[model samples]
Target: MSLDVTSPPVLSDVEELVPSRYAVRIGEIDVLVISDGVLPLPTKMLGHNVDQRARAAWLNDMFLPPDAFDWALNTVVVRNGRQTILIDTGLGMDPALNLPRAGQLVKRLKAAGIDLGSVTDVVLTHMHMDHVGGLIVDGVKEQLRPDLKIHVAVAEVKFWESPDFSRVDMPPGFPDALRAAAKHFRKEYESQLQLFDEEYEVVPGVIVTRTGGHTPGHSVVRVASGKDRLMFAGDAVFAVGFEHPEWHNGFEHDPEEAVRVRVRLLRELAETGALLAATHMPFPSVGHVAIEGDVFRWVPVFWDY
Candidate 1:
């Protein structure tokens, strides 16, 4: 065998790797962290008051690209013996905004052994495109379940439905997208719409609470069984949102109010030591935020591989 050094080395076949979808239990409720995909966000777009030099330095220190950051779009599924509840619908079937990297929620849900039609309820954290986009595909409703009920904050519905929404100047396609989503929500899911004004139980164990300012009705879903708890914070925080809770991002409808909501929530989460999952924190974006003096730090859940 030593004399066979003349033989060429063989190559192995290429392997395609995908991001892992994870499941963690919040007491008796089964929670599955599903991946929709990612959006490469510019750091500048993330914060209006973020110091350029400091942000760049932090990104460099973290070995991240100075110009861009990969924002993860994570959605959650909560299952009990009888009910299947979806936290947020990831970017749906829209072609214009559906980048190749995104629009994978349906496939990933199936991969996770969840039937599309088995989803009994969809809780829209807010009416943002990424959250509501997956509700409709190709101008037709992406029926998760024929009898599926849809829940949204009352303020959120009113915000997008108002004629004044059309009058307000927004980015070229943004207003149009909002109009389209509102139309679909009103027309297709009208009877299915369950509007809430404040914290209310969607079912016995799952609840929705308004966390506004990211939008008029931006909210979070809290699922608890026994003493275990997990909060699905939709766009409530980004990768750096917890670290720099004061920095205002462009995506927020009201930067000042957004900061206020974040600060109060961070403090409460810090005190309770409850687990958190955000849409743009990181894949399987589950963790806890620890309070350190005046600022909070992200403590990612350790993967026990």
Candidate 2:
């Protein structure tokens, strides 16, 4: 069943096409955030905190337009010793989503001198369409990595696999493909799926920590090599606004819990002085947390790429 490329799949025009840089080294581990494209969301999706008037003010201050928000889709690749692991697959070849190059992750992986078959594991923070879309290629029998172990949070697996989600009021104007994607998540990727509880170590230096609330079983991975530590914060913080550490994204399943987790994580990152590689902050989304006058800011690292 090859993914149809001619027609718009479900979530069209949301994935980006601009090619971006690919690799960063953190201590002994090498990290890469590959571009799966970008999504253009209405500025209102940012949040309701800013009224239309405040929205205009904020956009003007940023020197950006007040109408829409362009957010990047980043898929992380972590390498240690002979092991290569990917966290989250980007939007797949979903024509409805308007992503022609949705399944370029494998291509990018190859460009990085890595092979999909060599990947030991693929950890998903949650089962959201964007995050898991690349796991399986449309119309293709084999997944992006046929041999790799696929891991997801137990709670997240349960949520996506359950029929109850249909009862919840979805976001306004949610796409039909997204709804269908949620329904078929389990049926499509159950063969290699491995569910974990709160915390578990996938490798000696790579640990999966529970940071739910965003999606019931949302989790983050911490990579430690020697004295250096870095966290792959997947959708925990979307943009620079997360710099506040108290603000939560509107799409979060449980906003209150999301904020609590964000605060605690930011505090921990600050205290540990660990590097943070955000999936959606910006291109080459690697940075550090800095506390200033009771507010936290994301200090993006300078990449020579």
Candidate 3:
């Protein structure tokens, strides 16, 4: 059940694409892992503070391209009794973004046999484009499930609303585009949007924890049913974190604080042996963290049939 960091799972030959949706159980609750698609991130954008040569060596060790890496997009649907909540919405199909292969969440959800109408709540981990883009369909910004109540962290909204947020230095028009997208979603669903702070139970069995660092109000959702615990760590740590927990990523707003959060939470997760699901790990990104010596390693869970 545990694999070392140096040796990861490998696929041989040209295997047919696996189902975009996968089902797993956390105690009595049913969790459906839905894929949106993959994002090709330039390697230079990662490990901002790490030496380029060292980073390249690490990437090569994983049998990955040293120039760019593929980040899998995954979202989780938790169903328990009458409550059906989504952890995060994936990137929506948008041709303008030029990500031709990255926005198939709608199709993936359907393949998972999830009735969009049955979803009563959407708990957002953050407001980044990839995480919130799926809220709008057909260029219309609204709740995916017409009657669903949307939940977001209170600090997340406050952070995005500040003028400073818009002034933050980013590539050319990225800041403007980010603010625009966030503004549209907030305005479109202002009526149904619910904001929360502190560790609170959002649903009967799901608890949302404020673990900000990547963004001002980034969070993690924990689902507890029976005696099992599954943590949905939204952008808290990527695959590279296993080998370099202190590596600062370019996407983070507060680099130092991000490292603190990643190291602390990853250590705790490893000690407690809890199941983890993240947005940017490989598809159906479910795994467990392991502490080897003084660093952390990722032990991806074998897909349950």
Which candidate wins on TM-score?
A: 3
Per-residue lDDT tens digits of candidate 1, residues 1-305? 47767765663332116654888888888989888888666677567576799788778777888887777888999998788988887877556544677767877776777887888888999987778767675533564566888889998888777634422334346556666766775776788888899887888889999888788888999888999888888987877776788877767777888889888878888999889898988889889989889878989999745
Give the per-residue lDDT digits (tens) of candidate 2, residues 134-199.
765664335346666878888887766553333223345444665566556667768878879998
Compose the digit string of candidate 3's lDDT tens values, residues 212-256: 888888899988888888889989989888889888776788878
Deviation of model 3 at 269, angstroms:
0.9
Worst 10 residues of 2 by lDDT: 162-171
Identify the runs in model 2 with alpha carbons over 4 angstroms from their true place: 1-19, 99-103, 139-146, 163-175, 243-246
Q: List candidate 1 segments past 4 Å from native.
A: 1-16, 138-143, 163-175
Clash number for model 1? 1
Query: Weakest 10 consecutive residues, lDDT, candidate 3?
Result: 163-172
Error of 3 at 300 (Å): 1.0
Per-residue error at 167 for model 2, in Å? 12
Quantify all predictions' global Cα lDDT against the true fold: 0.78, 0.72, 0.80
Cα deviation at 292, candidate 1, in Å, is: 0.8
Model 2, clash count? Answer: 18
Tell me the TM-score of each prediction against the true structure: 0.88, 0.84, 0.89
What C-alpha lDDT, on a 0 to 100 scale, does residue 222 get in candidate 1?
87
